[model samples]
Target: MEDLRIKHVSLELSENQESHRTQGFSSAKLLVVRRGAPFRVSLQLQGRAFNPQTDGLVVRVLLGKLYVTMPVTFSQSGSPSSWRAYISPEGLDPQRLSVFLQAPASAPVGAFRLLLYVLTQSSRRGYKAGRFVLLCNPWCPEDSVFIPFEDQRQEYVQSDSGLLYMGTAMNIVSRPWSFDQYEPEVLEACLSLLQVSPPHMKNSRRDYLQRSNPVYISRVVSAMINSEDDRGVLKGRWSGDFQQGMHPSTWSGSGDILVQWARSGFSPVKYGQCWVFAAVMCTVMRVLGIPCRVVTNFNSAHDTNGNLVIEEFYSETGKKLHHSTDSIWNFHVWVECWMSRADLGAGMEGWQVLDPTPQERSKGVFCCGPAPVRAIRDRRIDLPFDVPFVFAEVNAAVQTVIVRQGQALSFSTDSQRVGVLICTKAVGFPRPQNLTADYKHNKSPNSTLRSRCSSVSEDVSPRTDASHGVSVSLTLDKAPVAGEPVLFAVTVTNTEAVAKVMKEHLDAQAKEYDSSPFDSFWEAHSLIKLAPLEVKALHHQIDPALCEGVAGECLVNLAVVLEDVRTQERVLAFEEFNITSPQLSIQIAGGDSLTPHTKHAAAISFFNPFSVPVSGELTITGAGLIQGKVKYSMSALRPGGRVQQQITFRPNMLGAKMLQASLALSNNTIIRGFKMVSVNDA
Candidate 1:
């Protein structure tokens, strides 16, 4: 480990501008060898600015064919105090040379000398670069194999503790040595000297605690800074909304307001059904200065029937009732917060749970974590909070015909409790109380009704002039499940000037139409019209047995057709959607690579997202995937393990190359990612 000499040679730069600045030569060479041990030498060069043409630069040592090049151009510009350069061949003979170089014929010639030194770098951790001493004894035979420092790596021992080294020279070394001449024990001992081990527990408890409790585990998990500086567990834009007055508190409050705003309506929009709730909770906690994030995921929650009912009511009802389910939760976004002992005391600590709609709290809790005990945050509170509310206002008018289909429909009112007027053409159907009270001045105010409300009364003969018409509407009582039969009821209203004529118009159509045409023909005329209203009621039994353990999703389609003859317009009203499969989940495996430059194989698994089983191919994709087969592997992954195949990269060429590949599991599935590697040629 000692007696390795190092010398700093002067660098001479000739005062010539047009000379070939890059040419070089060296003035001397050094020899290193031991009689009975391995003959090896390493040079550590520290070069300075020099003129290559006249003051040439180059080195030839050990009377061997090995040459080290020094470009005058880079040497003059490089400011590093020193640079490392080594020469060693495992099985090569040793010799020395008075290495020197003359400038090429293309440029001016001058004189210059640059700094240089030689050293043998130890293979141990924190082993400073220095000269190595010979280990051979003179008593050894002359024919003994002489190995170069590079070749002697085989002689270096592998330490008991596994540690891979990035060699300064011999870079293509492989593992599990195949050469029979290699001595594993000697190699291990040599490596043992190179291995580094930190101190064992000085004060067992204190040292143990230092390792047990990380200095910044929570900080790493909840930080929102860039990946280089921050090691947060959760990902995505959970932290970016703090600006624009969108602090967690403001955002959460706004979401809570939306919930309260949707309740009071003839058709209340179903808002606040997804992240709305989580947004509120996350905001409230964030305002309290807690580091929190929302994560969406899915799991099975047992239903009252004790059968797992993948939650579908939230989405179906949202879409059908409100005309949209855009911001609905996909998996189920819940908030995770970094909690401390003090926070825990508040009963809202450590990833608090705020599932407000749980019917069976235990069942909802079942979906929280695989191991329910592990998922518990704090003790559950069975008591209910003030129910958040929302509201809406709906307005409408109604008209009726006496002789034809004597059905009634309602319209919005300005009364204490909003209610609609029902209009019909039947002879003895009582007048609507609200309407009767308005028309107390006369039992049948034909002129007034014609001018104001567009009413149709039945009494006189048929006439050419009629007052008004009616419209029919169909709407849903609530969202229904897919694959279920639905019962929809309708409401009709009539308003006309001439009651007798309105009756006659209905009579004419009644004789020509069956029950089916009654709804349609009434819708066709504005004079003897039908204002339709309908509510949906669905009843269907879901047999899990039908799915055969595979996830299945069904989309229910509903349509109501109304034909208007006066306007010649066909109005089709319907809502079509998938009852299940509103959420999707994917599990990726076998995607671990120590470094970016290396190509690692991986497998991706796609799930139905819902508790139901779905059949589909999974697509896998990766960056720096030099070669591979299959995107979504059908192989079921082992728990806590991965299903994977190998991808290889041979760095035969230098520079950066992108490694990317994709898996096309099913027609709709695709997964991808990438890695990087760097190589140096000396």
Candidate 2:
């Protein structure tokens, strides 16, 4: 018997216009439709037309475990022009089959295959017709998560530049977090990551939500991306020493991370920090058709004890002690997913925060959030899924303590210092949107909404009243440069009527941008009596040797306290600065434009201004422009010498491509350079 052939398959968006059409049946030609939405598919069959009453034609669709069969309905009068005119050897028109399918609301998301079969009086045979994909409906009101239509398109559908905020409020660091989700490798990696069950979840059977819920998928992704646990896909090791481990700059996009994880057979890939983890999570969520965006919280608090207060103990000379459990990060990056909370209930639906950084544990697992952003803003600590944890991250009080001779001399609490700039990528654009105001209530006194979440006030440390007589100001010498001294100047002015005796204390500490201060780089103490209207300047210099471990970017927290000897009143000032690594200049040799399938060269130059020789490795990577790893090692570079290297690559894809070069020095220093090149089709 001859096998049946499918001549054409067309997807009808409406009765008036055709949307997608393919000449033959194939999985590559997919028809995408939302669940609960009705879609029509038209298939033109090769060979002589058959009488439906006698032929018994039927179409069967298979999606995962779901299987359904329906009778083929054809209209002879409204058939396609080619279908009505084409005649086979038997002198009859070819058969045209059209079927309208309505995917059930609970239908699982997956690829659906269609098969055409005929049942005669004796035997039956089926031929593969076509395949399509069904996605959950974000438009349906009952299932919609209330994300803006444009956000759903730009954030969830399109892969492009994202924003990751770093550093503290005083020194904000903003950089582009590239997703590159449109790449085939990235999509495959996302699908693969979703399928891998975490260690704790292995024994427990997964339910429908566990398998298909966006919240569950996002939570699992958070844990799997970081290899902190046995089930993690990437082994995360943070080191300022680049020669000791993988550099975060080595990977250009999330696709690179995912591809590496997959190639290693789902083993822990390499390395990732907060920003890297958040960026990769965004890529996975977007590829899985979940609306997601990266968010950065400046002065983010890590309140380990559920008390919304981050305590910092400082020595008299101004060294931050690491004895306390509570701490504050310069900045922390995480992702927010938009989804309806069928598990949590109605009002909780919307943007849910998911942190893949693996800093803290939620539900005995090394994962955080699926915590509703609405709950955080509303101070709904009673809600499930780590609501209190996320709330403290954005609305915690920062307490600075001055301890001398094993005694607590003074303490100051600032409620507004933590969570300074909460930012995310602007909807429909690459720029950042400062969403700080959305997460916290307005500080204005007359604002009525400010008190609605007043229940959170009980958990925070009490704020001290500001002393009106004395004013303190702290300023850094310049934009902090690595391998150089950082000078901090503290100026105190006394506006009181009489001369006052005061003791001055200053503390400078180097800390991880996403965690608490490691150790104090420098500290100073002095006693000075300033007369009325008198101003005094106290300066402290942090040596470059003390900051040697400061790799790419280091966070320095400065605390200055002045105590009036007679009254015992203290004036406090705190400042944070981001010390950036020395930069390397990368320039396209000729220009920034290239033709597809052509070779191009770029020059990377860095000046060794230090007395010691510098030795490191240079890594160049580009998504569509370069194929594989291009690395060069520099053994030694004499002091006061300028070194230049050339890198050549061939472009395979045409578009705007970014070529990034990172120099990881053996002295625990890393600097990055970037150049944008446009590739045109030849």
For each candidate, give its TM-score against the true structure: 0.20, 0.78
Quantify how close model 1 is to the true structure by its C-alpha RMSD in Å.
30.5
Candidate 1, run of 10 with poorest lDDT: 165-174
Top candidate on lDDT is 2
For every candidate structure, what is the RMSD over all alpha carbons to the true structure, in angstroms? 30.5, 7.5
lDDT of 2: 0.66
lDDT against true structure, model 1: 0.22
Which one is best on TM-score?
2
Q: What digit string (tens of lDDT, one per residue) describes model 2 on residues 1-682?
A: 5434456767653331122111111212345555545566666766445554555566677754456676544432322211111112233344765555555545555556877676655547677766665555555544344355854554554444454656544444445445766554555566566556563245333323344466666777777778776546566656655554466655556766777778878877667788888888888776655678888887788888888888877765556677688878777888888888888788888888898888788877778888988788889888878888888998899787778777887777787878766767565443456666567777322111111101121112222223658877777766566668877777778887788888887777777675567666677778888888898887778777666566356777777777788887776776776766666788886688888777788889998755588899988777667766588998799977888998888887655566777788877667666665777876
RMSD over all Cα atoms, model 2? 7.5
The positional error of residue 532 in candidate 1, measured at the CA in angstroms, is: 7.1
C-alpha lDDT (0 to 100) for residue 377 of candidate 2: 84
User: For model 1, what is the error of residue 110's alpha carbon versus the real structure, in angstroms, after optimal superposition?
Assistant: 60
